[model samples]
Target: MAMALETLSSPIILFFALGLLAALARSEMTVPEAFAKGLAIYLMMAIGLKGGVEMAANPLTGEVIRAFGAGIVLSFALPLVAFAALRLTSGIDRVDAAASAAHYGSISIVTFVAATEVVQATGLMPGGHLVAVAAVMETPAIITALLLARQANAAGGPVAGSERGELLREVMLNASVVVLVGALIVGWIIGPEGFEPTKPFFVAPFQGVLCLFLLDMGLSAGRGLRQGWRQLDVGAITFGLYMPLISAAVAAALCWVLALAPGDSALLITLAASASYIAVPAAMRLALPKAKPAIYLTLSLGVTFPFNLTFGIPLYTAMGQWVGS
Candidate 1:
């Protein structure tokens, strides 16, 4: 309860809430699209660099290898579970369900960033390899979702005008994946001493920058909900709310089996719980054009993102503490 209150009142979250509220109230305020894009790049670069530096400080242990493998397995497997649930519980068609399933299997970078803040505040530093794990986890569910959609008689092959390699390009070279993985490698090469020169720009200002980014995210989410909510049925909306908890439970069990530390476990749980709004949406546009963005995007960005930001983080934190203890 205390953790939840603290998180809700934090400047980062409060700013997000402010944006959400303003948007819901139908205010005219807007963040410049280009500038918001820049903010996203900056945040991703900062965290990628930080994670790389930490990873450089330590050799990759067997446990780290196991965590990486676990993450991949989860990424590939979760969509199957999500697809089944969505098909059974919601009125959405196979393509939409498959598209939505891909999102559930994927991780949200912004949510991971937010969870990192909470983890850091609690003085439990998560491993850098998790960033690598996050990078690895980005695309497999995409493949799975495509397969599921095909199997269910949803459109097969590329959408008209999509090149043979377009889906590959979308998955591999997407802004978040490229910037994150590239920055991580750069940071790994630079090491701590080399990163020191950029500390003022990258490290000290990170939290404030994050606050600004979250505010924009909140606005995006709120606006998406306002415009797209009608596309989501009650069951679909409920799935968005509950699926994260389901994923978190699955991750918690894996964390316990793998014997991860509380900090690491919490991060993994959060990643598993988060739904992809950015990466999956782009892929869906190219691959499953028939799939309604209004359904998947609103559910992910509006319902799931806010829930994870507000309540899921605290619950996952407690789960981590319990499992680690």
Candidate 2:
């Protein structure tokens, strides 16, 4: 428990807390929306470049392919479990449950990045291909959730005033997914030697940029919790806190089966456990409009995200070590 508190009180989480408090207090402090968006893109590009450089140093083996494949499958499969859990445990209806579950199953690249930093701080080395795993894990849960929504609302008419293909477009080309994957591919094509040319801009500014991004995230989460938290009852609120641990435990078990190294195991488990704010939330806005974005967004972004960034990363990393060993 002391360890958990130490992890939670880390500078990154504290910075995030500062933003959350500022937003909740209705401080006029703000990061320009356009600037925030650009920062997000820059962060993605930096992570992708780093991953590609690492992959260049290592050969792409069968294990790498297997890991990516497993990530895709888990991303596809976990939504079913999450959907059932939401239906059984929360007041959320079918459409909302399905939409919310998709977010839980999808990867949060920021959370993964944060986890990577934590593991590195602990002197553990995660595989660079984990970035590829994150890329592969982005879209499958969105697809599964859409399929679930289609089945649940089959008898009912289509969502009113919703355009055709909006959900599909959002799922396929959400800002986070497009940037992360595109940058990953760019990095792969350029390789480490190629990435060196842009290192000063992409590499050096990363930490400060992340701090700024987290500040915005904290503000968004605070405002969200302030507005939408009442929608969550006790059961629902508890789910936000506990589901990541559950997901991580399951993913850790999978890591053991796959014989993943400690570092890579932890990274994959963290990705599985971290719920998407970027891709899934935007998709929910279009796909499940009747569903309250505030509720799920706040729950995932406001509640669970902070939890994962703070204590959940360390817990999962420790668990991954125990299991992988």
Candidate 3:
């Protein structure tokens, strides 16, 4: 309860709420798209660098290896679970369900970033390698979702004018993956001493930047919900709200099995609970052109993202602490 209150009261979350409220009220307030994109890139780069520096300081222990394996397993497996749940509970077709399921399997970098802050505030520092784990987790769900689409014969053939290897290139070289992984490697190479010179830029103002980015996100989410809510039925909307809890439960069990620390466990739980809006949408466009972005994107960005940001992070934090304890 205290944790939840604290999270809700935090500046970043509040800023997000403000944006959401503004958008829902039909305010014409907007963040410049180019600036918003820059913010996103900056946030990713900062997180990636920080993770790499921490990883550079530590040896790759057996536990870390196990964590990586667990992340991959969750990434691949959660989408299957999500697809089943969505198909059974909602009126969405196989392709749309598959597309939406892919989102639940992948990590949301912003949500992960928020959870990292909360976990750290709880005095548990998650490992930096989780960033790499995050990067690793991005694409596997994509593969699974594509396979699901193919099985339903919904994919049919490549979209006209789509080049060979285009999906491969998009999946592999997507902005999120590329910036995150590249920044991690760079940070690893530099280590702490090398990172020190740039601390002012990367570390000091991180929270403020995050608040700004999230405000834009809140606007985006609200706008998406406003525009796309009609496309989502009661069952689909309900799925958006409840599915994270299911994913969190699965991750909590894995955390117990892995004997992870509270901080790392919380992070893993949050990652598992999060649904991707950015990368998956783009991939689905190329791969499953028939799948409605209105459905998947709204569910992910509109319903799930806000829930995770406000209530879910706190719940996952407590769950992580309990499991690790």
Candidate 4:
């Protein structure tokens, strides 16, 4: 309860709430798109570097390998569950359901970042390798989604003017993956001693930058909800709200099996629970061109993201503490 209150009242979450409320109220306040993109890049780079530095301090071990395996398995398998749930519960067509399922299976970097902050604030430090785990988890769900679409014969023909290998390029070379993996490698190469001089830029300002970025995210979510909510039926909307919990429960069971510590457990659970708004959506645009962006984007950014930020983090944290203890 205390953790939940703290999370809700944190400066970053509050800034997010402010932006969400502003947008929901139809306020015209806006962050420049270019600037928001810049913010995203900076956040990704900082996190990657930190994770890399941590990896440099520790050697890869069996536990780390297991965590990676678990992440990949989750990435590959969760969409099947999500797809099944959507098909069984909602009237959505296979293409849209598959696309939306992909989003649920993928990790949201921002949500992972937010969870890192909360976990650390509670004096539990997650492993740096989890960052690499996050990067690895982004693309497999996309593959699963495409396969699901293909199986249902819902993939249809490719979009006109689409060149072969375009989807592959987009999935592999997307900005999020490239920046994150690249930055992690750079940080690993430099190590802690080399990172000292750069702390002024990447370390000190990280929190404030995240607050600003999340405020923009809040605005985006609010606008998406306002504009797209009507497109969702009760079943679809409820899926957005409940799916994360289901994902988190699955992750927690995995953490127990793996015997992960509290901090790492919290982060992994949070990663499992988060849905991608950036990478998967862009890929879905190419691979499943027939899928409606409004459904997936709105569910991810509007309903799931807000729920995770305000309430889900605290609950996941407690679950982590329980399982780890």
| Candidate 1 Cα outliers beyond 4 Å, as residue runs | none
Task: Give the C-alpha miss distance for residue 255 in model 1, angstroms.
Answer: 0.6
Which pairs of residues clash in candidate 1, taking residues 3 or more apart in a chain or in different chains?
none
How many residue pairs clash in all the candidates, one count each?
Answer: 0, 0, 0, 0
Can you rank all candidates by lDDT, best first?
3, 4, 1, 2
lDDT: the better of candidates 3 and 4 = 3
lDDT of 2 by residue, 192-213 (tens): 8899889999988788888888
Per-residue lDDT of model 4, residues 185-267, tens digit only = 99999999989999999999999999999999999999999999988888998998899999999999998999888988899
TM-score of each: 0.98, 0.94, 0.99, 0.99
Which residue pairs show backbone clashes in model 3? none
User: Measured by TM-score, how close is model 2 to the native structure?
Assistant: 0.94
How large is the C-alpha RMSD of every model relative to the true structure?
1.0, 1.9, 0.8, 0.8
Global fold similarity of model 3 (TM-score): 0.99
- Overall local distance difference test of candidate 2: 0.84
On residues 163-197, what C-alpha lDDT tens digit does candidate 1 reach at each position?
78888999999999999999999989999999999
Q: Indicate the residue-level lDDT of 285 in model 2.
A: 72
